[model samples]
Target chain A: MRALVVEDYHPLRAAIAQALRGEGFAVDESGDGEEGAWFARGTPFDIIILDLGLPKLDGLEVLRQMRARGDQAHVLIVTARDRVEDRCAGLDAGADDYLVKPFAVPELLSRVRALLRRAYARKDPVLRIADLAIDTATHRVQRGSQDIELSQREYTLLEFLALRAGELVTREDIRSHLYDFRSESGSNVIDVYIGYLRKKIERDDLPRLLTTRRGHGYILGPA
Target chain B: MRSLRWRIALAGGALAALMVLAGGAGLAFYLQHTGEQRLRVLAASQLQALAHGLEFEHGGIELHSLPESGLGWALYKHDGSLLAGSAWPGMAPPGSKLAAPAVTRITTPEGQAGMLASGWFQPDEDDRTGGGEISASLVFSTADIDREQTGLLLSCLAVSVLTASLAALLLAAVLRHMLRPHTDLAEKIAALEPQCRGQRISTATLPAELVPVAERINGLCDRLEQSYQLAATFHAAAAHELRNPLAGLRATIEVAAGPGGDPASALATCHQIVRRMEARVANLLLAARLDAGQVEVRRDEVDVNDLLVQAWEAQATRAADRGLEALWDLQGSGIASADPEAVRMLLANLIDNAISHADRPGAVRLQATTTDSWVTVEITNPSSLDGERAARLVERGRRGASTSSDARHAGLGMGVCCGLAELLKGRFSVSADGRELRAVLTLPEAAEFTYW
Candidate 1:
């Protein structure tokens, strides 16, 4: 999955970005609200971590402008304003979650994971398709009780495809979700990762769960 | 008297009592005068009847019959001889003659108080034995009139007392009713909560006399609310400044505890974050102390040049990291009569601010000079702060536009520097020319150092 962090404080921003990247998320960072807004308008991020206090523009105005432009990314506000009124205002401004500063990294990661689940309209942490099971929380996959191991990039792509099981996911969708703005991968990187995922998850003993339509996209359900 | 309502009521009651006493006194005097006049008229009529009843025969006067009126009467010859009267001997002095009709109050020899009327009359031809005038005197006792006057006075006193008492009570009740708005205002003011901002006394229903009082109180409330809002903003800004580094420190430690995390780098970052927090807290504490007048200052001789150099050396690493150079122009005598610790603290904050905000690859200029027992130090740097932001540089918790990116500077340094300068009996000022910012600090020089 891909995410964006918008915070003015350097050390805090670096820490948050580092923690998210370590969790296998392709993360993009901005130092101010103006640049953050610009990035939000230009990219299709799955989640946006925002701070309230910013220069050149306030974070709430940026969120308002983003929502006005119909961006559907889930926003999690992290700020030092701990007042009840401040929290209510942040939540009322279309933020998906709120977290005060000095928060534990584990809790932030858990909240991000939950927001991602909500984004995909799934209540369970594990996605099931026929006999195949993918534990999203553990980033592990199995087919008919046979454990499968995949690389980080391969896992991310498979997770994206599995989230939309039985539905066609285009290559552009995979590229936006699997890579950030800093990623220099060519157009075929998505196809390369998909091939790697299929080699590990597909077997001769099981029915083919990965299928591709001609000149269209890929699906991760029964063919 | 402390209660305004009671004061007004008491004054009103006293005035009413005074007026009632004066009116009652006048009424009693008038009743006594009329009563005396009535008695005089009755005595005069009885004396005339006695004069007419006299029948003079053989040059002698005789009363045919004494009228049954409750009066004493006597008839005397014109020569002051004995007359036919019942109480003449005790009514007047013996041999007292009447020349004309007259009335007078008298106390008879018998100690009877009476009004006496006396007159001389000429006898008619048919009833005269000789051509001579007859004198008659009548005396009416004033016992009943005196009794009636006393009773009237008693009744007047009773009525005056009753009226005065009633008037006092009525006046009190009326004043209380009229002053009800003042009471309501007191209750309303007492009910105001200090925490409730924008709560004001309504003057719309108040009396015209009390409108100004209510308006003044409302104005005070407005000022208090503004002060409360400013304090809240300052607290929030301080929290933001402190909590951001804490969060960073916590995240760094967490990351360091994870697998493949480097401990040395995380520890360095945590130390840096803690030092930054410590600096901010120190600045805040100094500011609070300065505001409360709790900071102690000494007049020890301080070496301005040494303190400045030390301050620069302390922040040299930071300046070098930011790729900035320091230009020194220390031309002063290098001495001032100020507290050494305060001067060091002030120089440290100024240099820190200069290093943090100065443009990279630019030089920060530090200059010092002395003029007649005063040492002045100026720090100038290439800054991006506009005129507006620089003007407010000394205000507590006010940060420059670009400071949001840096968590190490909490905008308290400048304010604390200004406060410390003042505590050391110095002046501090800042000015911006849109391209650069300059801070000037002037302090008193040592008395003996002036000759050096």
Candidate 2:
């Protein structure tokens, strides 16, 4: 899948593109709102991320055109304004979701997935990789033919890893997904959880679907 | 009617009433005393003239000169005999005539007097002329007395009444003039408005006694102007700083969710980041609004319980989506005095903060109580003592700190919540349990207390 990033600031835009590439999405970039609007209208995009404050054509206008042209592509609006009126205005301007800037990479990837899945009409809401399966509807997990009974917290951890499957999820990405958890959560908690999941799934009989990426988070996919 | 003006007017009116009464009473007493003294002097001199003209001849006492017109007299002898000369005309005895004359006092119709002439009789038994039994004695007519006394009293009372009325009018005019400056100053003060921050109380030509007071008012205005300027600057800077993070977050989401993307993976990541950024932004803006005191509270009759249910609905989805649990113990239809929008925002911020900070798989408790005059809502979540300190850090985050500094606790969430509470004119308190955090907000009951 491909995505478009519209931002005026160079450093911040580059950082965003780097984060998206790391998440395994092909990223197309625009420095201003006018060019961003042209790219959005001329090219078919799977998702369009917009900045509210942009040079030339404003980000809100770009969003308006995308919706006006019957482009049903998933649109996420990102802005520095967290005011109630600002949020209302963006949603009114045809944005599917709103994001504030300076966010962790994992958060960006998660919202991207929720929007894309609804757009493409994925039948199995639960994600499957080899012998491991994650049920999004019931918050359930299964390894091979056996049902794996995990704690609510352990389920949340596994869901984050399963969302990306083969991609290298970082420690920061895992931390960001654990919204209810704190930055002070122990550094090895992820490694320990991965160990617990391997034992519970009886990895010997099932194919090894969960693998650690050294300093990064565990990946749930065949290498 | 309850203000200082009414109070001062009442006091002035009472003073005027007292002055009118005292002046009227004093004037009456002075006129009566002077009138009595003047009447007595006139009557006594008349008797003196009658006594000086007495003459005895041929066995009878008679007046040598013509009797005074409009005067009448009667004489009594020691033998209880009565005599009257032709001058005695049709005189009657006065009510205040002396019963026995000597150097005696009397208050006749003629007015108060001291009679000086003796009352005696000379009989014809000495055989001077034909035995006619003639007798003589001094007499002063009391008729002249009445006319002269009445005239004196009427004149004196007329003068006294006129003088007293004039005095009262003068007194009132002076008092009202003395009070004019104070009343004028009071009116100016009452008319002052908050928007008139630059106004200086002009007592430049006022009475010397009010100069210091006017100077103090001017000094206060100066302070108010400085504070207002600072607050405006803070608001502008805060808005500018907040937009940076917002722009960056949207840019990342647009690219990841576009064409060459793993639509599933990129969209999921974008949702998480947006939710987190929204939380931070909401809190910061709330603080700025609170600091500026710009929250417009459109007050309405609101059910606290209903407001809570709505707030919980917004938050419950997010918490469930994150694998968290929520519980509530709400009072049924608790009525409160509040702005509905303000109350909802208050509830939303607190609940969202709790859902984000509460322990995973742990329960968040929301409880509400309503009293006759106030309603209170409290939210309890998993927390520790360290969390309490961290919460304090968040509360103070937006005030006078370097935003560029990488401080973990100095994000916008708690600061905005604190600001919102102030703007709503409600009370907010945060405390930590052994392993939980609690936030409580108290608002007035609209049925009992009004916003103003």
Candidate 3:
């Protein structure tokens, strides 16, 4: 994936560049906001990483110019200001995402991967890991050669866990993801749904991919 | 004369009043004495005429050209013969030979009268005692004395009233002129506004008494203008520096931790970043607010025990993580009027300092006490310094420096604490016990203090 990095600080900018490169992204860089805006307006990229404070022109103006010129590449705003108004203004100005500074490298790579994957709009989107395929486009689950008939909610629960494979997914995360909300169910509904997904998608002999991290939260990863 | 500017007017007027009264009284007295002398001379001349013109024939004496308006004369001979002439009512005629010259009061058939008499008797300047013949004269002239006294009284009253009025007018004009500079200064001060901070109070061409006051006012305005600009610059720079990083971090977390990503490590890292971001934002906001003079603290009487417990809730987790024991000994209850937000900020800073710097397992103590006049809260902790060195830690806080090894924790130095203390209408100081550092906060007792 290709991304544009707009920042003035040389060390921080280089760090972001190296992190993006490790994540397999072709990155174009600009130190000044005016040049960055021009480059973004003329080219097509997978995502645009724009800093708020830039020399010669402000970062908001750059975003406005890019949006005005009809460029819809995913624009993520980067700023040191963790204020509510700044975030709201950036998003309202056509920024697809807003991030505060000094972020971990893995987190940045993950967000870039998510944005790229979303832009693709997978037809017949399915989440698969270790021989289990939960087809979102078809609302069906298949374990090896077995065609599992499952309810819509059980399929959603299995799909949410299979999306992030090999990491602990909290019950809160699973409940929220399956229902598109924080759970109103008696807090053990996630355990019941996981039981259903276990019965439908995994063999009684297979190792589990969904796990729990006590007291902290949850994870969806390899056993 | 009652006006302060009319010093001379009042003094001169009083002196003038004294002089006028004394002069009027002296003139009245002199007129009375001179009038008596003139009346005596007239009486003597009348007696001489009476002695020369009298016709002592048989048993009567006849006198002419008498000027007879309440004037009467009588003659008495040494031979016990009485002679009277002229008819004027309310008059007295003397009997017997006069022993000496006199002015005496006499009683007549009508009323009391003044008679000026000359004891001169003559008989053709030859036989003055013929047939015991004697001549005596008495005159009545008391009405003139009454008129002269009335005129003197009227003149004195007129002079006194005129002097007082003149004194009042003179006093008013001089007082207004002397106070002119102060009035002008007041008008200039009223015209000044915050936008006119660059404008200076000019003392040139003003009274010498007003120059120092004007200079001080100008110096104050200059400092205010500089400080206002400094605050503006700080806010602008802090905002500009923090905007991009925070935006980037928020976007990264929302996408990375939401769905379809490694959740365990990502959430942990995101939480840490959020905590730091929250601290930095809070500190930056506070500094900007202090510089701008924007926050109006709502001062109210807060129970120190209640406030200490509330502050501890926010810092308890951090304290536990650092292995420091946090405790409060709130004794006798006392009230202190303070801004709750500022007090919270101050106590958090103090407790945080203790948690970061004190040795592992070291104890932090917050104690509250009140005398009759003042309520004090003392927060003490274990430290490496003693006595004077501990005292210097407080001075360093007031002066915007760190005196501890854990100074970098939370971005709040002692200077911020000092600033917060001032905002709360209180004082922040430090003391020590041997090797332990103790910070003290003393405020006026809320029950006794009055707010403007």
User: Which structure among the candidates has the greatest DockQ?
Assistant: 1
Residues A1-223 of candidate 1: C-alpha lDDT, one tens digit per residue: 8899998776788788888877778999987788999999998999999998775567888888988889999999998878898788888888999999989988998899999999999999899998888888787888988989877777777778888999998888877887898897686777777777788888665788999876888999987
Ten residues in sequence with the least summed lDDT for candidate 1 chain B: B399-408
Instruction: Give the number of colliding residue pairs in candidate 3.
Output: 43
Q: If both were scored by TM-score, which would come out higher, candidate 2 or candidate 3? A: 3
Tell me, by lDDT, which candidate is best.
Answer: 1
Encode model 3's per-residue lDDT on B1-452: one tens digit a residue: 24433565567667766776677677767876787687677666666765667664544445555645335665655553445544344333344446545555444446544555645465664443355446465666566554765676677667655765565666557657777887788778788898555788888867998898888888888888877765654554455435434543544454454444445544665564466457556656776677667767787876766777777777777677656676778866557778766776777767766664454366788888887656788887776545665455443212122212222332333445666777787788766666576777876668654434
- Score every model by TM-score: 0.76, 0.39, 0.40
Question: Can you tell me the CAPRI class of model 2?
Answer: incorrect
Candidate 1 has an fnat equal to 0.53
Candidate 2 lDDT over A1-223, as tens digits, reads 4578786554457657666555544568886677888877765566777877664466777888888888877888866656687788899989999987656555776787778667645556788878778776555778777788986557766766776778787776665445321134566776777788777765556666777777656677885
Q: Which rank order by TM-score, best down to worst?
A: 1, 3, 2
Write one digit per residue (lDDT tens) for candidate 3, span A41-116: 7666768888876644678888888888888788888766566887998999998888777666566665665665
Candidate 3 lDDT at A170 equals 68
- Candidates 1 and 2: which is better by lDDT? 1
Off by over 4 Å in 2: A120-124, A127-223, B1-30, B45-230, B242-452
- Model 1 over residues B1-452: C-alpha lDDT tens digits? 29999888888999999999888888998998898888777777877777777776765656676645346776655666655656555544234445546888877766878878887777788655344766667777787788889999889988998999999999988898999999999998998888548699999999999999999989988888866765664576577767888899988888778755778988988887787677777776776677557899988888898899898987787688767888999986878999898898889888888876664368999999988889999999887667666767777656422324322252578878888888888999888776787889999988885443
Per-residue lDDT of candidate 2, residues B92-203 (tens digit): 2232334332332333445533232333333434433344433233334434554665565566556656665665566556656776777777777777777557677798
In candidate 3, position B15 carries an lDDT of 72
Better of 1 and 2 by DockQ: 1
Ranking by DockQ: 1, 2, 3
